[model samples]
Target chain A: MTNRNNAVNNAQKSWLYRPENHKKLWWGFGLILAATVVVQLFVSVHGHFGFDGWFGFSAAFGFLSCALMVVFAKLLGYLLKRPDNYYDDDA
Target chain B: MLELIFPPAFILILGAFLIGPIRAPLRPLIVLGAPLLTLYTIWQMGDGIQLTAQFLNYEIQLIESSPLRRLFATIFAIMAFVGGLFAFRQAKWWELAAAQAYAAGAIGVSFAGDLITMFLFWELMAIFSTVVVWCGGTEGARKAGIRYAIMHLVGGVLLKIGIEGVMVHTGSIEIQPIPLTNIDGWLILIGVLINAAAPPLSAWLADAYPESSPSGSVFLSAFTTKTAVLALILLFPGQQILIWIGLYMIFYGIIYALLENDMRRILAYSIVNQVGFMVCGIGIGTEMAINGASAHAFAHIIYKALLLMSAGSVLYMTGRRKCSELGGLYHSMPLTALCGIIGALAISAFPFTSGFISKSMISQSAADQHLMMVWLLLLAASAGVFLHAGIKFPWFVFFQKDSGLRPKDPPWNMRAAMVLLAAACILLGIFPEWLYRLLPYPVDYVPYTASHLVTQLQLLLFSGLAFFALLPLMRRTLTISLDFDWVYRRLILSLMNRLICLLSCLNTALRNASNRVFSIIWTYIGRHHGPEGMLARTWPTGSVVTWVVVLLTVFLLFSIY
Candidate 1:
C-alpha cells in the first residue's frame, strides 16, 4: 500500500512540473540571429553607403556605451551603499 | 479619410463614455476593440497627408505626416493594440478605457504639428495616465498617482506659459525651430525635459511607474518619455545643455536601477537611462544623432515592452515582483524566462538585437562631432545598462536560488503578448531595412562591422566579467532606492511631520496661557463686582445712555477735527 502511494505522488508531481516548450522559442530566436548576421555581412562586403556605414558606427558606439555604463555603475555603487531596508516602512 | 481625422482619439473618448456603465462580461471586449479600431484608422492616414482642424483661435493639425511623426505614431498605435491585448484578460474595463485614451493622447502628441496641439495632448496624457495608475487597485497607487498628476500638471502649466510667451514675443505660432537663447524656447525645453524624466524631477518616473498595474506599466513605458523625446527633437534639437542633462539622466538611471528591488521599477529607471541616450543624441543633433534618437525610440518601445511583459507574466503567475522573493522561476516559467532573457540581451545591445542596431547612431554622431567626453560617457552608460537592467533583472528573477514555489505559466493571452513582442524585438534587430526606412533621415546606417563588433564584444564581455566579479555587491534586497522624489516623499514628509508636531505644541501652550490670563481677569472682576461692591452697582439705563452719548459726541468731535 505504501509503495503504491509513492508511485501516485511521483506521477502527480511529474504532471505539475511540466517544462515549457523551449524548442519553438529558441529556434525562432536562432533563425533571426543568423539572418541578422547574414545581412550585416552582406552589407559590409558590398560596402553599402550612408545608413549602412552609420549602422556599423551605431553598433560600435552602443557596445562601447554599454561597457562604460557597467564600469560607472560599479564605481557609483561603492559610494551609495545603504542598509538593506534603509527606505523600508520605518525608514 | 479627410472626414476621419483624429478618429482614433475620438473613438477612445467615445469608448470611455460608453464603457463607464458597462457590465463586467462585456467590458473586456469594448476595452480591447477601441484601440484596434483606432490603430486601423491611424494606418489608413498613411504618410505625407496633413490634416488640420480649427479649434477656437488656433489651427490644430490632427495629422502631421512627416516620417518622424508617422514613425512615432505608428509605434504608439501598435503599443495600444498590444497593451489592449495584454489587459484584456485581467484588467477592469475602466483601466482599459483610460489606457486607450492615454495611448491616443500620446499618438495625438506625435502627430501634433504645433505647440498648442502638443500641449493639449500632453495634458490629456498626464490626466489619463494618472487614472491608469490609480486603477492598479491599491492604496499605494492613489498617493503615487496624485504625485504623478501634480508633476505633469506643473509641467503642462510651464509649457503653456512658454508657448504663450513664444506667441507674444515672436508674434508667431509656426511651431518651427526657434533658437535656444530665447526665453520662450528655454522654458519650452524645460517643460519637455520634465516629461523626458530629466533629473531633479526625475524621481516621479521611478516613484510612480512601478506602482502601476503590471500591464499598465507596459503601456506607461512607451508613451510619456517618448513623446517628450519627440517634443525635444522638434523644439530644441541642437541645444548643448541637453547633452549634460542627458548624461545626468543616464548615470542617475544606472545608479537608482542598481539600488531598486522591484522588477518593474528597475525597468522604469532604465527608461530614463535609455531616453537619456536619445536625449544626448538629440542634443548632438547631427544627421546621425537624430537618426539614432529616432531609431532608438523606435526599437526601445519594443524591447522595453518585451521586458515589462515578461516581468508582468512573472508577477501574474507567482503574485511576486520583488527580486528578493523571485528565484528559480525559470524552471516552471521557462517561456517567460526565455523571453525575458532575450529582452535583457536586446536591451544590453547584444550583437544582433534591436538595441544594437538603434542606440549606436548617437554615439557615432558624438564621435563624428569629436565630442569625445560625451562619447565616452555614453559608452559607459551602455555598459551600465547591461549591469543594472539587462543582466541583473533576469539573473535575480529567473535563475537565482530557488524560492521553493512552482507557479504555472501565465494564461494564453499573456503568452501570446510576450511572443508577439519578442518576435518584434528579434525582427527589428534582424531586418534593419524595415525599421531603418521609417527614420526621419534616409536609410544610410548599418549596425555591424568587423572592428566595431570585436571592440563592442570585448567591452561588454569585460563588463559582464565585472558584474560577476562584483556579484557580492550586487545582491538583491527588498529595498527602495532614494531618488529626486525622495526629497518630497521622505525629506519633505519628515519635515512636514516635524512642523506639525511643533505647531501642535505651540497651539497647546498658547491655548493654556490665554485661558489662564482670562481666568485671572475674571477673578479680579468677580471680586470687585460682587453684589455689594461699587463695581456691581447698576446705575441703570440712564448711565448706559449717558456713556453712549459721550462716546458718540467724542467720535463726532474727532471726525470734525
Candidate 2:
C-alpha cells in the first residue's frame, strides 16, 4: 500500500513541486518586489492621506493589517468557534 | 411594430411558465433564449415611463427607464442567461423555472416605475427564491428556506407599510429619490437594509446561501442584494448613516469569513463585504460615488457569480464543501484552478482586474471628499479582502496540504459559463470605459496610473505574504463560527419555547380554577335542590300551593295600591 501510494504521488507531481523550481519562484517574487520599489523612483504617489505616501507604505500597511486581522480572527475564534455540529440539533 | 408594451421581466416569466410544459432536449433553448430576448427589450426601452395604468386611485407604472435602471436590468438578464446555462442539466427543471421567475422579479424591480409596482415584483422574488433554496432538497435546505422566507416576508411587510405611509403622507407614488427622515422613510430604509444583508440581520446570507445546491447558489448570489443596492442608490443616496452601517458590514464579513471553514460560506461572507463598498459609496452620495456604487454592483455581480461558480463546481465534483476536505485539485483540474484564481484576483481588486477599476472609485470618492478616516479604513478593508477571500479561498481549496481529492472540471456548460464571466472580469479591468459609460453619472476617474498599480500590487502581494506567514493561525478546524443568527436560530426559538411552556401552564391553571369554580357552584345548587332538601321534600307540593296563593294575594294587593 505504501509503495502504491508513493507511485501515485510521484506520478501526480507536477512542475510546481520540482526542487529547483522553488528557487525560481522565489526569484520571480523578488523581482516583482524590486520592480514595485523601483517604480516608486519615477512616479510620485499621490497619497490619499498622511502615511500612504511613505516609501513602501502600502506593503507595510497591507502586511501589518493582514497579520493583525489574522491574530484578531484567531482570538475571536476562541470565543465564537464551536464544533461544526453546534447547530446540528437546531438544523 | 411591437404593439404589446411588454415589460422585459415578463418575457422571462413567460419563459418560466412555458419551460415546465415543454418537452426535454429543447428545454435549454427556451432557458437560453428568454434572457436574450429580455435583454433586447431592455435595450429597446428609452428613458421614460413606458407603460402606466390606473390601479384604484393611483397610477401604477410598470416600466420605467433610466441609465441606472437599465444597467441593473441588463445585468439581471445576463445573470439569468449564465445561471440558466450553468444549471441546465444539473438542476431540476422546476428549479430553473423558479430561478427564471426570480430573475424576472429582479428585472421587474429594476424598471418598476412606482413603489406599488416594485413591491409586486419584490414579493415575487421572495417567494420564488425560497423555492430555489428548497430545491437544495436537504433537511437543512428546507429549514434554511423557511428562515429565508420568514425574514424576507417581514422585510416585505415593512416595505409595504412604508410605501402606504409614504403615499398617504406625500400623496405620491412615483419612484423618485428620497431621504430617510420620516417614519415611513426609515421603515423603507430598514426593509431595504435587510435585503442588503446589513448588520445584526446580516447572518441570513451566510446562513442560508451555503445550504443551497451547487447550481442553486450561483442563481442565489445575483439578484436580491444587488437589487437592494439599486434601491438604495435610487432612494437613500448620501444618507450618512449608511457609511457607518457599511463599515460594520465590511469588518463583520472579513472577521466571520476568516474564521469560516465551509468554502461557499466564505464566499457568501465576502458578498456582504463586496456590497459594503457599494453601500459606502451610496452614503457618500456624490455623483462620482453613485457612479462608483452602480458600476461596482455591475462588476460585483459578474465576479461574485464567477467565484460562487468555481466553488460550486468543486462541490459538484467532489460532493464535499468543507475546505478541510479539499486540496490538490490543481493537479487534475487545472481549468477550475485557473478560473478560481482569476475570480480570486478580481475579488481582491488586484491591479488590472474588475475589482481594481470599480472598488477604487469608492475609496477615491472617500478621499476626494476629504473623509480621511473613511478612506483609510476602506484601504485597510481592501487589503483585508485579499487576506480573507483572495488568498484564503484558492490557497486552501486548491493548493493547501493535499487531501488526495482529484475531482476534475465540471461539465462543458458550467465551464463555459465560468469562462465567460472570467473573461468579462478581465475585459472590464482592461477597459473600464465600457462600464463607465453605462454608469448613471459621467466618469472622470482613471484606474491604471503607475503609482496606483504599484501600490495595489504592493498591498495585495504583501497581504499574500502575510497569509503564508500566518498560515498556522488560519488552520481550518471542523468548527463553525457563531454569528448574529444565534439570536433567531437559538435565542428566539428557545424564548418562544419557554413562552409556550409558560402559556400552557397558565392555561392549565386557568382550566383547573374554572373547573373548580363550576363544580363548587354546581354542588351548592345540587345541595339546595337535592331530594333530602326542604324544597324537594314530600310536603313541598302542599307548601308550594299555599305559597303560590299567598304570592298571588300579595301581587293583587300591590297592583290595587
Highest lDDT: give the candidate number. 2
Give per-residue CA lDDT, model 1, range B447-484, as digits (tens): 87764564455446545656655677767765565566
- lDDT per prediction? 0.80, 0.91
Reference-based lDDT, residue B462, model 2? 84
Model 2, B98-165: lDDT tens digits are 99999999999999999999999999999999999999899989999999999999999999999999
Candidate 2: which pairs clash? Answer: none
For candidate 2, what TM-score does chain B get against the true chain B?
A: 0.91
True contacts kept of each: 0.13, 0.86
Task: Categorize the docking of model 1.
Answer: incorrect
Provide the TM-score for each candidate, comma-separated: 0.81, 0.90
Q: What interface-residue Cα RMSD does candidate 2 give after superposition?
A: 1.1
Q: TM-score for model 2?
A: 0.90
Candidate 1 per-residue lDDT, tens place, A1-91, comes to 9999967755654332323434564466456434444455444432123432443344444444554545555566556545555654633
The DockQ values of the predictions, listed in order, are 0.12, 0.69
Task: Report RMSD (Å) for each prediction in the order shown.
Answer: 9.0, 5.3
True contacts kept of 2: 0.86
